[model samples]
Target: YLNSFVDNIDEMKEKERYLMEELKNQENNFLGIKSICSNKVDRVEEISRLKIEMNRLGIFLKNNQGLNDFSIDDIQNKIKEIEEYYVSDEEINNLQNKINEFKSKIAYPIIEGVFGILEENFSIIDKKYEEAIYSSMGSRSKFLVVKNEKIGNELLSSNNSSISIIPLNKIKPKIVPGDILRNVRQLGGIPITELINFDEEVSKAMEFVFNGYFLFENKENARKACYDYKVIGVTLDGTLYDPKGTLCGGKIICKNIIFRRKDLLELEQSFKEKKENKRIYEKEKYNLNELKSKICNLREIKKAKNDIQIIENSIKFLNKLIESKVDYSSELSSLRQNIVKKIREKEEFLRRKNVLETEIFELKNKIKSKKEDEKNILKKILQLEGFRRQSEIKISKKSIGEREEESLELKRKHLLQNILKSKSKISKLRELLKEFKSGKNENSKSHLPVQFQEISDVLDDFKLSSNIFNVDLKIFDVKKEDELKKELFSVRKEIEMSKNIKK
Candidate 1:
């Protein structure tokens, strides 16, 4: 009986030990529950703060002055109009201003030791043969056509370093061979010296310069006269054929007053384009600022929504822990699962945000690249203009001749054609860029609720379709109108030149 009692006491001791262990485990579980509940409370506070921030950002975005003032369609239409408005008149006015400014800076040299200056300026009698005389004279046209030899000698001895005086008195006319002359006449060619209407005093100078040269109607006749008949020949288009089986022909870029005008016009056009591009960049930057604010608000709303979800999940877990019997292992497993799930959710949000931010960064980089390209193009245009102006200024300071004017008019036409082509390309690029921006804006709208996204997409599609239709119609109308206007302008210019020639 005593042994049995001892066993019972030992059993009670074992039971006490078991009870104490269970009590310690319950205390540990209580501490864990407290920690989890505290964490849930902290998450609730964080969620509330995030909600407040989101609401604030939303309100700010909704009330944004610039963004709220205009509808998207209105803004887009204004941008399109700004892009399409023609600035050619501005270019022309600026060019005229620059030409006037350059002319104001020119200073002519004064000869201190020269004798009496005799200026015997001769005009072209026949406009049809003006090109032939100008081509035959070549660089000699820059020289002053004077009749007195002593005046030329005195001018050459003067202190003036800029004078290029040519006296007709000292010139000896060259006599062409009879056989060559006969061959040239047989080829429907006229001697260049015979085409000019000049004073008798200057006849020797003209003959000395172009007595052996013959002008033909075309290159084929000129080549026949030179290669087959063995005589020097020139064509109206400035092709030169020598008697020694040599031919020189191509477009001539003469350094004269007429070319200077063309260069100035091109520079003005480039400047206007650069200015327009700068304005576009400025406007885009302003729009980007508004977009950035809107994106910020969207990101905040997304973060707030995620925070609310995490907090709600944490509260639910805490509630489950409070209502159930304290099972430490099971509660730990549940808490761990919740933590892992929350971590995955946060990671997903971060990844989405990163992707959005990356897209924004890429868009910014593209804009920067375009700006750099535009800057480079503007720099190249300015450099070319500077070089052209310097070269033009270095040439002789004389009035533009009829042939030079004609050449300049042709060059201007060619430049206009090139400008038209460039403008077309620029317009196409602008349209593409506008479409890309519109698409990007549409993509941004996808982050909103599904119902809102659908509505926005429908509106965007309608606007896009309308824009496309209008653009097609406008392009067709503009093309026809521009062609007619160009033809009329050309005809008017020809008539004006004809009247001037008659005068």
Candidate 2:
């Protein structure tokens, strides 16, 4: 019974060792799957970043053109959300170990086997995203074949029958070997590949290099690895890879290799049927690339036209201002010149009139001095001849003298009133004479003489008229000036119109 216990202990030890090895294997397999998923996730993220950068460039271009439709802030928020799916390798390894530990806890072999199958199945499905990235790059050729659209409509429909040839050089694929697929790689990232459908009628295949590398990198490696990717060659028997199509990923099979049936058994399964979906897939990819380029060019053209129109409008507005200002220019110049000439003439006339008035004032002072001397001499002679009043006169002389003095005062007062009245008449006559001399006489009394007699008659007539209406004679001159201004305005308008017609 003790020997049986020892045998049982040995069996348990063997089983434990086996379980440990299985656990280790499971861990390694999960790690490998995680690496593949990580690579896919990287590819998805990198492509997304590049698309974002392109969109940013477009936004900057619009901003430079003064358009304000897009917001960089909003785009940055979206980018932050996309970043959430990224996972570190260390974290993935930790998760893998946990899954392995959970799987090892099953007691029955059947249960363990079932769990292993499940794990393997999940891992395969996860690997499909990586396969998508490889397929997208591999089947992408300048030359592509159209496929039937029967399988879930993943390929083109039969109603449309054509192949599309895109020059690979024109396609802007943003991937290099180092850039991994992020969806398969990152746990929560978007799928690394996009499937598109094509109309076979409008599709055609062509031969060209696909440039999928940094422009400034080393020439040989960048060009050969990226631009010179090869496609499958067609054979006489209508077989793609039977002649030579690479079954294993990332290697190209160009020349036909004959192999025995035993060698064929050793080789991996050839996915010739899957190539049909790939062909339509490639055509759809080329179409999408062409469409994107057309869209970019159209946006650029629209921006250019908008800029041109703005400049054109500014030029037109300035031209209109110039055209409108031109019509007023000639009249403005003539009026300015006439004003200057009149100012100069008025200045000269004022200088001459001042000198003439000084001479006239001196002559009037001399005449007044002569009249005063004569009156003084007559008063002295009358004092020496007092024979009428000295003696016998004491009596009746007082009444006769009083009466005569009263009569003399009355006569003097009448003469003085007449002289004062003559002053206004003389002033008006002198003003008329001055205006005539200055060549600015616009008075209606132009036929009247410059002498005092005619001036007195005109002044008397003005006084009589003013008394009758209780109006000042001076106001008549202001009324005449207003009428002259109205006449001048009408004349100016006529002259301007005539000048425009001549022009």
Candidate 3:
């Protein structure tokens, strides 16, 4: 019976130990379930936050896309406006046609009705002689240089006022004597005929026009040499002085009628230059438009690609989170209930944190706005202080009486009247004194002859003494004592009146 009792005690001890170990294992499982629930809650919260941020980023991207489109449209509009001022190909073509037409007309002869005379026959013999020939003959250089006298007669009989005929046969060359030519050369002058180059047939005509006229460096030397030598003189600047005293002088303009070929060439060159400039500007405008289009396209494409990449990354992150998920079906119901309660607590804490953070942000914004208002108020205060200082300075610059007293105006007018009266009295005194000194005062006519003569002698003596002493003693002259006294009294009265006005 003793051995059976001992065996029962041992079995009861082993069963108690097994029951304690099972309780510990169940507690550890509950803790693991709680930890898993907490991890799930954290992951869910992070996903919610990501969704909100993504929504905000999407809206921002959408707005930026709209702005980019508007920018592109604005650039396109500017390009269109620039196009309005751009020269077109059609206009350039029309200008080119006009230039061609001008070239064709320039090749025509200056004079039209000469017989068998082509435009080549009327050429300027030498370019260097163009100015001298043009100046000597004037518009006659445009006439055809023909050997036939009948053509010249026919041109003159045509009665066209614009046409001039210079016949080589009718021209009689003026022979300048050798002595006159030697004197002209000594005086720094050259014969005008020697300065020009022309055909032998036109030699007589050139000599008839400018043979005797000598060209000098300037007008003064030409005028002096011309009068001294008794010959016609022409200055290098086209100033002409004839022995008959006829003078013709002014600026010598190279008339386009004289250089018809040169004028045509210059006009054609100018037209080509303008056309080339227009083409360059058009090419530049086209290149600028193309560059702007390319830049805008690249920007749009890059922005869209970046936005797509960000969305793809976000989707990848979500997929990764889904792949990392674990099943928690074996968790205890009590732990799951605790996890749900804790999640609600965590949400409430987040809400409170958001509210507190929003309050902090609002307070910070209020502080920032107040600081800006303070700065604006300080600026206004400084401006007002500056105005106040300026006003003070202006007030200080004003006269005290002008600023504070209305009666000063009346005082000024009264003082001016008194000053005028004093001036009049002084003028009358001066006139009386002058009359007395000159012996022309009617009031002093009753004086005896000897007394007047004696007064004149005294006045003459006083003038001599005053001149020697360099003093103004005229006021003390015996004949003008009363007038001088009156002048002194008037001056004193003016001084007193001025003092009273100041007070």
Misplaced by over 4 Å in model 1 are: 1-120, 125-128, 228-230, 252-503
Give all TM-scores, in the order shown: 0.27, 0.13, 0.28
Q: What's the candidate order when arranged by decreasing TM-score?
A: 3, 1, 2
Q: Relative to the true structure, how large is the alpha-carbon lDDT of every model?
A: 0.57, 0.40, 0.58
Candidate 3 vs. true structure, TM-score: 0.28
**Which tens-of-lDDT digit does each residue in 97-157 have in candidate 2?**
5444543542212211111111111111333233332333344422222222222132223
In candidate 3, which residue pairs clash?
A: none
Give the runs in model 3 whose Cα sits over 4 Å from its true position.
1-144, 157-161, 256-503
- Compared with the true structure, model 2 gives a TM-score of 0.13
Could you tell me the lDDT of residue 277 within candidate 3? Answer: 64
